[model samples]
Target: MTTDEAREFARSYVRFLESMHELAGRGEGNEVVRRVQEHVGEEGRRHSVVGRGFAPFEQVNVQVALDRWSEQPERTVVVEGVTLPPHYGPVTLQQLLHGEALPPTRLTAPELVDLPSGPGRTTACVRNGLFLVDDEARGRFVLFARAPQPHQGEPVLQLELAGLPTDEAQKVLRELDELRTRHNVYRGQTVELAPEMHGGLSVVFPELPATERADVVLPDAVLARIERHAIGIADRREALRAAGRHLKRGLLLYGPPGTGKTHTTRYLVQHLAGATVLMLSGRSLQLVGAVTQLARELQPAAIVLEDVDLVAEDRGFGPGSSPVLFELLDAMDGAAADADLLFLLTTNRADLLEEALAARPGRVDVAVEIGLPDSDARRRLLDVYARGLRLEVSDATQDDAIERMAGVTASFVKELLRRAVLEALEGEAAPDGVVVKDEHLIRALDDLLDSAQGLTRALLGVRDGAAAPGGGPEPHPHTRQAYASSLSFVAEAGPGLQPWR
Candidate 1:
């Protein structure tokens, strides 16, 4: 037959099929539907066809496949007005079948969407309809449709290789899969497991600014250890791998509440730029395998699992143990030793973790305890958090205050300073010109040390004896002298003079 004749015949056949589909849709053509199904089944038995089903809203994936398939441009067939999976809306299906751009109307409910990368929350919308995307190699347009209800009843993706052999079609599908991976939706973004969707994760693009290493209130030694092992190891992967040491390392940060564990993790995240950061905690830990696989694929990735003891609790002790712990272990063991993956796990209850996980050499190479801030560390924390405060006092008075705050937890120091600023602000009608003074701190301490606020103060890391009416230990004679000097100096220097520590 001539090329024109063959084309006419193909068009005629498509029209006939469409008519049959329409008749069946109206409930008057059961025989036609059966026959079409039988014919499709017979063809499938005769030829090796490459096909996959994607969610109707996953237009980007379908578009990538279509772009890859459109290079040869043999024959294009489109079927429309079909019922798709219940999860898909009618508009999305119509857009996919008609090759029209997706409407701006939101498809995903507000709660279902992951955090967006932009300033405003982004609702899930199909960005484009079926379109061509160019790759270095082959190109092909795809046939995408929402299958008719009472039929297969799903969104279908098919790559038509009109006269090509089975092997050639398989090669095309493989190439398309590679392209899909290259354009992965989650690449370069943080992700968290979605328990609602089994085996799937939701994207979480944290807008957190990178924290400074010095700003983290942990001990210098502990900070140094984490910097060397977790952040530094990721930076010098090539050098370590060349020296016969593997790049994969696990560091566990264990501490009580408000002890700067998470603060340290944020510091590491800031230091390790260009690496994928996977933040998992709570029920999301079930996706350990999926997260590890992604980390392996995207090397130089960091997996920050906060409160890991929730899942890694000692398996032998009671019913609270998580079955996902085994999965976590498998994922850790399965990864290549030199893959440049960093596992940073944090937990308040380190003693509750399984010994196998904690003691294992490759599983946890370094464990750092982020204990309560010591006297000197507490002094530094006070200095760090009070950076912008206008303390109308002399250096000696500020030193006396810091010395009085010694042995307080970092959490207490932070809250104490914040409350002091608030107290200072309360005394002035205009906040623009308010300056915190020694009396403000004294009043703030008095409020916090009230007998009724004992529990609150304890939760904030105030020791039992430290919750006295005046707050902190009794000042020595020299400390009181320094405070008097500070008051005199403040009166002489004027109200806005900034206190130096």
Candidate 2:
């Protein structure tokens, strides 16, 4: 810059140092504030400061960047116990250094907060800390991370570069940005977002169920269709990009509740090894705009919205009028076509989404129905759920149970298997082995089909069959077959029992 600009910049730098000292002087007994001033005094000989702020959800990434930047040669002196009021709102480095008044001071040391670095894991992050660093690359600079004081209006993870020239500060920030991106804690991790204080988001690395393709109880063609839309594209993203195909596509899984939509999603998530997975459901779906931005940044990403019908309560509404649902569609449409992003949405009431999907046509490119499991799928679900159990039952008994389980959901099958185990252990003593027998399966099926289980059946997503759970006469009761509790068979049945693998 010109000499005039340099002089003004230097003057600004001097004023910044004076502001910090003034802040220190206000808190006489606060050792932390005094140390902060002392460090600035030493480092501000010929330096200035630059600052940047990140979303509160990025606390984990900020901590990661700091840790990586401060590795070896560059040591960090963490000031602890520094606190900011929930109402305090500061943006610039100078404003942050110039905290509230003296006596009842807001200084002790910088605060530290625990943030999730990975699923079921967390790293202690510097919250409002004055980190005195001796950087081997960019030399000494003070840094501050604005904490998770959600009440502090629009509170963000503020990071500043103090004690450096303007140009140097910019370069350091760029480096930190690179580090944050390269070693992001959120990358390749499964995160679930929820609304925190005000409208900010709380990002947590949830240990989503690690479902496998074999474990997914869906028609092979349907499963393959979903994979081709999501995983298939993600796997061949480069080739698609080369062939002028847009990677920012959407997949809609529409079905009744308990139809394995979520289970199928888990399978897709597990298969996409390096893709960042962002899952939202219920009220969380309201924060789609902000989440879409994150998805854009973390490409090769999957955005899963479970049961989106919860937000689109008013169906048959005009285009661009349904606020929440339209916002969701708009967010999907906002994504860059070339971005390797997949929007995976699940909904039990596909009718509710018809208008919104129509408004934003290309947003949902592939729509698949995760309908009631057929006989084959039901049998496979039984096998899947019984994988851990020692099931020794006759072929006739197995057929009877499967035949009676028509129109039931995957959840029903899962619960049925569990109930069968309980039935086996009901009155039996520990004989040579504890095996699930014909009697147990029969009894459990009978109990599940009992009239008293109407609500339970509805909860398990049982459409029809027995009493139609909803107490309404649904056409095609059982949808295909019926819920039969009268399977007259003996526990021994002449010893034609086969052990299930």
Q: Pick the candidate with the highest lDDT.
A: 2
Residue range 1-501, candidate 2, lDDT tens digits: 999999999999999988877755555545544655566665463465577877767777877887787775556555454555444454344543443253334556446667677877889887667678766666566776666555655455678777778898888788888888888777878998877656567677777767888899888888888898889898898999999988998888776678888888898988886999988887778767767888888888999998888898633225655577778888988989999999999876666676566545677777777778888988898899999778999999888888877777889889988898888888583586568989998888877766566667667766656433234423332332221110111111123211111
RMSD of 1: 14.8
Worst 10 residues of 2 by lDDT: 483-492
**Which clashing pairs does model 2 show?**
79-110, 80-109, 81-109, 82-109, 465-478
Residue-level lDDT tens digits of model 1 in 191-212: 4443334333344556676679
Off by over 4 Å in 2: 1-50, 72-81, 85-92, 96-103, 133-141, 162-167, 194-203, 313-324, 467-501
* Model 1 ranges off by over 4 Å: 1-82, 85-170, 190-201, 313-322, 358-361, 394-407, 429-432, 464-467, 470-501
| Clash counts for the predictions, in order | 10, 5
